[model samples]
Target: MTQQPVDDIEIVAALFQLARSGAIYTKEVLLIEAKKLFPDVPEERLLDCRRQLGERLKGSDYLGYSDEYDRQRRRKAS
Candidate 1:
């Protein structure tokens, strides 16, 4: 299936929600939350989405994944 274009705003929102929910017990669950926020996003786009969100949360420090990305994003408003 062709994936839709997912903007940064939705990606940031999903990160915050997943972090706030505090129940992302599994990778699949995290992916589900991502898809919920970005319906057009494909499964493989999760990492890309996370990276996009990281850019907003960490500026150019988006050096891949970090344990702090979600925590920091959750503290900010959507």
Candidate 2:
């Protein structure tokens, strides 16, 4: 059977979906999750997804969202 192909847009879309879920998703987990969504995503595109995800997230206004995810992540790391 032929393996399905993955695309950059799909990977970025998954990142956005995960963020909307309000979970503390890290770069590593996000990559894994993206893999699950698009098993055939190229490693290069996956790397780009990480960069794009960060760019989009860094520009987002956290005003409408709670910091629980952020605080919990910090506490766990600490």
Residue-by-residue lDDT tens digits, candidate 2, 1-78: 986666667678778888678774577777777777666667678879879877776668467343666778899999
Lowest-sum lDDT 10-residue window in model 1: 58-67
Quality of model 2 by C-alpha lDDT: 0.73
User: What Cα-based lDDT does every candidate model obtain?
Assistant: 0.68, 0.73
Clashing pairs in 2: none
Q: How many clashes (backbone N, Cα, C below 3 Å) per candidate?
A: 0, 0
Q: CA shift at 5, candidate 1, in angstroms?
A: 5.9
Model 1 agreement with the true structure over 5-47: per-residue lDDT tens digits: 7666667677757866878766567777787767666766776
- lDDT, model 2, position 50: 78
The TM-score of predicted model 2 comes to 0.57
lDDT measured at residue 14 in model 2 versus the true structure, 0 to 100? 78
